[model samples]
Target: MDRTDADGLFPRWIAHRGAGKLAPENTLAAFELGWRLGWRAFECDVKLSADGVPFLLHDATLERTTNGHGAAGARTWDELARLDAGGWHSPAYAGEPLLRLDRLAEWALPRGAWLNLEIKPSPGTEAATGAAMARAVEALWRAHGAGESGGPAWPLLTSFQPAALQAAQAAAPHLPLGLLLDHLWPGCWAVARGLGCVAVVLNHGLWTAALLAEQRAAGWRTLTYTVNDATRAEALLGWGLDGLITDRVDALGPGQPATA
Candidate 1:
């Protein structure tokens, strides 16, 4: 897609991990909360279960968010689905089951929500995770008729792992991809270009006026993550960022003023 095509597909404000810090991250409950709060674009992490089912999760282990132990990817979808994924956040969301990507697609596609699926792979499973997730997303979008006939944009696949993004590109070249970076690692830009990425998502602190200008000149969209402060958000927007993935869903969103 050209820049204009890409522009129509994405929004300026994307809710990080669904509802961000409000609800359990990467759950349907969080997504619903974001939707209610007027966020149409969302960014979430995706990994493949041992059974090859793609699901929403951020960490390699389940200890932080879910009531489970050990590697999340080690569990099959059947096993992972039974875990209480919300109680760690609060009592009201207790018993919220782990969400499969297909379920999320079923909910978001019909509603025209844009998604940025970050391919978060567990150790030793980068290639498998990327390939599986690409296939899953492709099938889901095809089934729902998304990104066609003027529907919602196709979900963007992003990752910190070059191997994973490479596998994704091989699996579904039609899908748009982005490279995630925490810093300007050597050869990172070259890798992103080689992978045919349309954008680059960076840590909020990594952006500068000069960097933004360079990226714009290079014809790549620029986005940053986890920005919650209104003052900082204002600065980034003023610098012409394409998007901001923020945790302050309740406070910062489309049409909401940037307040301190």
Candidate 2:
């Protein structure tokens, strides 16, 4: 599909890492909460375990989000699945297990929810993680009959690592890709263009009216991340942003008025 066709699949408001700060990030509970609050679009981090299982997690290490220690990628999925992924945030979510990508696809595809699956590879495993995630997502979506006539749109795969995105492109060229940028590094635009990305996701502060215009002129849809402030969201939307990934799901979402 072309840029316009792809743009239709992305929603105006995307819940960041599931329900953002409201629940444990990257957990199934977080996604459920976001869905209940009327968010149809979500962004989550995906990385491959040592055994090549693609799972939901943002950090390279397990210390922050889970009860496990050391590198998360070093453990196989069987070990990772036993960790209390939700306990770090609160007791109410204790014992919430790590989620596999297939499980997420199973829940999301049937609901027709849109997903921005960020390929957050661990250091030194960019290519492997990307390729693995692409293949896994492709299989999961195919099994659910996604991308068929009148079916849900395929998930958009995005990453800050060029090698990861490139590997994903090589593995599944039909999947939509987006380049994530925290800074406008030298040759970043060139890299994104070379990857044939349909969208460019940037830090909320990186956007300006001129930059937005420039990207749009080049036929690339522009989106920003973690925007929780109402005034900033209003400004970005007024500047014609294609999407906004926000943590404030309760206050800023579909049919909800933005408030400070």
Q: Model 2 over residues 104-193: C-alpha lDDT tens digits? A: 998899987889999999999999988999999889998888768877789889999999999999999999999999999999999999
- By TM-score, how accurate is candidate 2? 0.96
Task: Count clashing pairs, candidate 2.
Answer: 0
lDDT value for candidate 2? 0.90
Residue 52 in candidate 1, Cα distance off native in Å = 0.5
lDDT of 1 at 216: 81
Query: Candidate 2 clashing pairs?
Result: none
Per-prediction TM-score: 0.96, 0.96
| RMSD vs true structure, all candidates | 2.6, 2.6
